[model samples]
Target: MGRAPSDSAGGDRLRFLRSFLASPRKVGAVLPTSRRTVDNTLDLAPLEEARWVVELGAGTGVYTRGILERVGSDARVVAFEVDAQLSSILASQLRDPRLSVVSDSAVNVARHLDGAAVDVIVSAVPFTSLPVPERKQILRAARDALGREGIMLVLQYSPLIERELRQTFTYVRRRLSPLNVPPAFLFACQGDPRSPAGER
Candidate 1:
């Protein structure tokens, strides 16, 4: 119905998995993301100059699929999935050489980025579950890694992050997509976030 999810989806590895009952941990897998979240997240930003886009928590390659479609062929997408199963799915799906799937925590965003400044960051992580400091870390990483004119697109289900986002960014714009499963909000922010000319 909605464009069949995305075009650049890596392969047929991602079969529609039904919710399975097991350990508490396994049961949590039932929280699989909706295609609407992915759609809303990627649709928020224009992908023209997204030379290097970092996708945090690229679960099951949903967001990854959308990102690959947006950027140019020469552009690179560095995606991170902290879960083992999701990481494997991401690796299999994004078999193309364009994507680099880091099977680790998104908080290690700085290390994972390898000193490269990203033109944009599209995130699908549920920031509502995290503590304020953790969210701040992620936001700081986004702002710190962005080029002067760069931006960060965070599609969170909570509007509460607005208070925190205002602390770091000069400008913050929010859009709502009620079509999503949980109704997501796209937050875009930008600023002259930079370190001193020669600080080490």
Candidate 2:
């Protein structure tokens, strides 16, 4: 028989804790993201109409499951999880054909896109913990991978990413989810200034 919901949740939390303990900087959080934060993040994303969505740092598939619920049947979600064990767990647990789990870094997101236009990119990455160069590289890659009208939603524990985000995109908006553990700042960014459409 399948595990009870409570048991599943407990397992998820344990997995998250182990992953975080293994690589605090990469995993970012000791617990799974709160439902409120997930709702807030998805509310800002244009997922219903999105053909392709990318999730960065998809720990325990919290945001990934939420994205699947909102996106249409034809929509595809590419989830990047740096933790190998967590990635494997995510792939096995969420057996949806539309979801692709990438056991890799977000910096290589574009390579896996196959030239399809991405409508939304949801990032739960711990940018504050990464090296400056790596952070910038990942941001730049995400910017280039998106379509002209694509939007990138980022969830962070602090506003430190605002400056880097503004440097990459012409538009940036921030919101706060106070109920999340340690709370979180959500950023919606578009209009990559380096892109030709952004220049127009």
The sequence of per-residue lDDT tens digits that candidate 2 reaches over residues 84-103 is 89999888888887889999
Q: Residues 22-57, candidate 1, lDDT per residue (tens digit)?
A: 222321233445667666666667775578998886
Question: lDDT winner among the candidates?
Answer: 2
| Predicted structure with the largest TM-score when compared to the true one | 2
Q: Could you estimate the TM-score for every candidate?
A: 0.79, 0.94
What is the Å distance of residue 50 in model 2 from its true position?
0.5
Q: So what's the TM-score on candidate 1?
A: 0.79
What's the true lDDT of residue 68 in model 1?
75
User: Which lDDT values do the candidates have, in the order given?
Assistant: 0.69, 0.88
Model 2 alpha-carbon drift over 4 Å, by segment: 1-7, 196-200
